[model samples]
Target chain A: MEERTVCEMCDNPPEDEGYELPLCANCRDELSRCPFPLWVKLISGLVLLLVLIAFVNFPSSLRAAAAFERGNKAKSKGNYPTAILEYERALARFPDSTVTMAPLAAACGWDGDLRKFAYYLEKLDGREIRADLADEIEEILLEFEDLSEMEGDEQ
Target chain B: MIIPGRLIALVTFPGVIVHEIAHQLFCRLCGVAVLDVCYFRFESPAGYVEHEPPRRISQHVLIGIGPFIVNSLLGAFIALPSAVAVLQFEAGTVLDYILVWLGVSIAMHAFPSVADAKSIWQAIWSEGTPTLTRLMVTPVVGLIYLGALGSFLWLDLAYGVVLAVGFPYLLVSLLT
Candidate 1:
């Protein structure tokens, strides 16, 4: 979704602030009316609010966007597992989404899961992969081959 | 609401809760009083935990173990039947729908909050040998969480379902 302010709890990127977990002002005020303990009600309200926002903003078609964002962040942070998780989410939701699949395959290639990279590449037909990403995937394949050779030597 | 739905993020949050519940259960096993537990998210969504601080890594790990146990069991129990029903039925009936819903529900729960993950990561990072022990436990935990994610990926529906289900895990993971 749109990042508005620094998250209230964790002060991360400035883009994610201001807004409460999921609710904008309109929704939060309504939830505040619940009869539960003020604190519990508030938290429950906030969480529920976030859910609503997620649904509205992060629709099926946009899942690719979410995946792209997630993969981008995870790749940058060296969290390959997490990045792949996001890319996988994108793939599942938007199976035909070429925008995300290419990057995701490149990421898989980086992780040495060439089977998946090739799988997605085949899906790409003759479409050109991004120049930079193609190079990156090629580099990874080379490294993976070299590593396997090293393993062979050790054996 | 949308945000709480995010709270239920697949890999990061639901998994974290399973892990935390693991820690909580072990704490109970070891005779520790459980106070409160939370995982964090940011801006519109976050989590918190207010608990009596444990003096030992063992206690910490026990609480961490909570989500792993919960999700693994949940994944096996819910996903199995759902898988069967989905396979057996061509066009879904109400009951099949219910089963599918149940399976998705269980599967959606397959992650940890990054917030909680960070805390555990910190706990592990801060300790040397203790961290190794924590690392050992994490894979077991992640395996179950992965099962939950696998279920969702296999089922593979619309983005809203995945995001509604998966975002919370990421939110929790990333924020923490």
Candidate 2:
């Protein structure tokens, strides 16, 4: 009996027409002159996409964290404008963060932009606020009232 | 032909649904507008995702083989915990058996259909196909053909068993 060699891919015996790489005739034709090109693209593309997703998300998350730290440092230095810009940039990358929003409201209030301060405060409404932050916001509101009274007297 | 397809679909309804969903998910991911999606029907094709053809060959390929990638991975992931239980010879709970069944069903349908293969072939031969892409897809096409042949001899089932049971066992053993 002749020793029949097997196709490496499917583990089936090679057809009468033997080929290199221990492949059967059908596998050779299928591989060299593929009838189903779309599948090749699909499988390869998906694997690439999976790899890309894993690579992309990690660095972007790190960048967002760095931006948040920069915003906090700017806020601490009493540079309200720079802090606002950093906070806005950070929020744009990672939106709906209460941590960023609270400091943003404080920055707006300190910069004497009551309208923007009120907007950020409204966003914080119904969410948990620390006792010290709430007292600071109350002080800002009292300051706004005093400014409103002075403007009324000037008018 | 209709009868056979319907019979197969009926027997493997979960696989059919997962297969169609995989195609639809890829279509959306590739930014192709989905015209229609029949997740499971009594028709010959069983289920289908009709969408606008993708502009690039890479996109077309991704959309075509999406199910094989998604289903196989999902099946293996879902089966891992249950696979551990089985390896430890724990009492076969209802949920464990269900997970194994679901995993096997999903994995068994990981191979793209012949129609899908034909569509991919046509795309490969179409204008502006890169030589590198052509070279890359040859072996994949052969493997797909092999998968089709394996289906006839219960090799697809064997593959599911390997993914759900064998691979998990190997992993658990390595970890221990």
Candidate 3:
């Protein structure tokens, strides 16, 4: 014998098929509403909005990071011009980023752009930087020094 | 070591609320009827979604794991810029801290509850359950139990940190 099915909530004939819960369209809609408290709705809505904002803003940051990566790769490969360009691109997206700035300064120094390198190095003075980067910068500065003018009498 | 779940839920209420929402949303998506739901409360369970048993194993799996997918992605996305700025670039604002907190709070609750594992186990082991499902899903259930056990050691908090903060750092590092 064929059995008849009915809505579990309203006890009416089911309107939608393929549902494990025997509910008509109206009851299904009602259940979907959830009736969560107002604050929960507000908070969840706020979260979704914030996440959307972040997602929207993410591409720029991602591009900046990618550009920074390209810069590092270029610098390592002695492609100083490409590295400088990529670093500039990253700086455009992430302005005043010390990490990017330090690397940019180092790249300029390696490329022998003394004017730009000295400018960046002077700007970085007294700024807290990674020890290794500080050492690299110091070495770059030493490259400009004359050995005879040095006061080291240990020779 | 045996602190109540309610206290933890109260502290991380956002995660609890989102977890319940994820469950309800999946139920709606699967065309299942939700009998009841509590997004958050100062109770033993903290939050819950009562819904009809799904007709398919795939639906059940989705419903059980919905929070893991939603919370992880949301949390990680929410934390990405802030985490990278503060942790990697050493630059951030007050707003970044707030966003990081929210992200960590959400990610902290990504694991499926042990009860969800038990239900899935029952469904998979029941009569007529496909062999493929049994093989594929058992590991998930095991992991859920392990997660439940690890919660005693605050592994959930660590998981949150790794997902929401560490992931973005890893992403940036990989690109470089």
Candidate 4:
């Protein structure tokens, strides 16, 4: 028996039914012509251009979250340098973002970068820390003490 | 494993490339005035082709399918020589064998391309589908691609898996 592939957009057999995940045939035909008046197209084009510029120029909130994820992953893998790199990236992308700062500071503390941690703490707005995160950071710092001692002995 | 990783990387590189090319190709075919292409690579690189998004879903789907169609052919070509070289690898040094394995692995996993993801995301976000339909379609489509590939065994499959996992990270970095 031949294996059948379904249409990706809509969950139907692509061969048996006309494709409609993105659009059916009639809808596709209709969209070919500009739906807006000519003026609307011009205005929307200009607006989109502006939005594009702004999106690029602005500090990215999404990047902050991504950086935090990367940092967490790196920490779990015991890659302190990589974790720091991710945190630094987050800081660069979203200087004023609290979400970036808190985890970044925590990572720095774990890496024994006390001065860096202090810097991030200073920059952080005075929001109360959640109990879970505060405890986690404390544990990371305590663990880092042993890590640094081991490194010191190895040297 | 070494050969597989390299093959996987080789296959993976083209997924992003094909996705962009698909967009550009469809624009030209639709008689739309092509302006320029802005391309983004890895986490840091970003660029775009200078044409408006197509008004029609058919045009969009054509562009979306471009990467899958192109890369699948490319993957086949890559896999053929790689498999041959791999079979002839008895005399090869450790490094030579490693390279071959990497190459083969990457080629095998190099498909169901990310252009499909972008196409799905755009279709969901556009006025093309009703709100309820859009909600239903977007996650379902994304999960299908992602969930299916979670267990893919080949090297090229690994590349696709990495891309699937990493692309969202890239998107978050770029969009936010």
**Which candidate ranks first by lDDT, i.e. highest?**
3
Model 3, A31-61: lDDT tens digits are: 7666667887787688667666656656677
Expressed as tens digits, the lDDT of each residue in B32-62 for candidate 3 is 6788888888986888898877778888888
For all predicted structures, in order, the TM-scores are 0.34, 0.50, 0.72, 0.33
Give the DockQ (2 decimals) of all models. 0.02, 0.01, 0.29, 0.04
For model 3, state the Cα shift of residue A138 in Å: 3.0
Q: Point out the higher-scoring one by lDDT: 2 or 4.
A: 2
Candidate 2 docking class: incorrect
TM-score (chain A) of candidate 1? Answer: 0.53
lDDT of candidate 3 at residue A8, scale 0 to 100: 69
* Superior by TM-score: candidate 1 or candidate 4: 1
Question: Is 2 or 4 the stronger prediction by DockQ?
Answer: 4
lDDT of 3 at A19: 59
Clashing pairs in 3: none
Which whole-number lDDT from 0 to 100 does residue A154 have in model 1?
100
lDDT of 4 by residue, A74-145 (tens): 977878778889868766655555555666677777677889877876775476655666676768767878
If you score just chain A, what TM-score does every candidate get? 0.53, 0.60, 0.69, 0.52
Q: Of the pair 1 and 3, which is ahead by TM-score?
A: 3
Q: How far is candidate 3 from the true structure (C-alpha RMSD, Å)?
A: 5.2
